[model samples]
Target: MEPVAGSLLAPLLLAGAAFSNHLTDSYGATANYWAIGLHISCWIAQFVGHGIFEGRAPALLDNLVQAFFLAPFFVWMEILFLFGYRPGLQSRIAKAVEKEVDKFHQSKLHGNGRATNGKIIRTIASLALSLAVYKYAHGDPDKQPLLTRWLHYYDSMQEDFKRKTYMNIKFVEEAGKDRHLFETAPFVGHMELKFPE
Candidate 1:
């Protein structure tokens, strides 16, 4: 909540500094210099909070574009939570966010191979789907049914990916014994799943 509040308030303070600079004649330069210093200090503090306290890189490092727009909205949501709004869903949302952050940090500690594997799997699946779509669009009328079936299968696979929250390569070891789990599991393309002999 502190971070969220800071995110909301910092910009307004900086804007005030700018307005002050614009209003003053001789002191305008001094005001601009102080404003710039304060802005840089705030950013440095944010970085320290993320790296030292949170033990993770700030979200802005990953997505500056989205962060610019979402930060205020996120702060608003935090404000609502503080006021006891969204009582039922807020806890769930908080837990999910915490889990994701833990996973992200764990992946970082584990050398990021899991992250790369996930990306590779997604890329291959995307390529396969794109190829299927292209062939379906360009192929003969008689085989259209087969192509449509193939597309539908991939679409279902995508839906399965979306439906499951814990879809990761770590689940592959258990997926063989629990075939039903695999139905909703994320497909890691080209990874062979083997059971104990």
Candidate 2:
């Protein structure tokens, strides 16, 4: 969310710099200096918001070219949400965003786990690593169980990938536990597993 807001505000800073150049041509050196200073200050504020307040890298650092254009449009949509517009699509968009974030975390774990050897050791290490990463990423105590369940699914998928076998996996959310049903092999039958939170 902070990344999105930072991305949205970035273009305003660019516009300010452009306006400062126009000021230099017409208004005088003093006006240009003030405009440039304002632009610099705002840029610093954006970085502080992202790095310090948000606890995440600014979106620009990840993809400078895309951030330059996308930030403003994203902010516009956020503004609409704030105004209670598009109420119906909010949950759908939120779920999609959650999936993307989960995918990113899973990929990060996979990348870090590649250095380790041995299937059992790697699986155990990856599970621990994923739990730690998810905990840090979420920062909400109540969501720990959900994160654990997500890591369980992720671990299963990792195992399936290594075996070069496709598994039909289905996730069911229940009151007391999260259940994952995996059809490992057609003739072998289905495996029902419950991951502890």
Identify the candidate with maximal lDDT.
Answer: 1
What tens-digit string does per-residue lDDT give for candidate 1 at 1-197? Answer: 34754676678879978777465444633544565457657765775676567655566655766567677567767776898866776798799989998898787788986655555465446446756865665476654444345555776898998767456654775776598776878987897779999
Candidate 1 has an lDDT of 0.65
Residue pairs in clash, model 2: none
Per-structure clash totals for the candidates: 0, 0
In Å, residue 13's CA in model 2 sits off its true spot by 13
Q: Could you estimate the TM-score for every candidate?
A: 0.41, 0.37
Which whole-number lDDT from 0 to 100 does residue 142 have in model 1? 58
User: Model 2: residues >4 Å from true position, as ranges?
Assistant: 1-26, 102-197
Q: Residue-wise lDDT of candidate 2 within 1-197, one digit each (tens)?
A: 54654676678879988885586556654563465457657755775675466444456555766568777666676786798856776677778989978875776566744432233354445446756864675575654444344555776898978665433222223312432233332465577899998
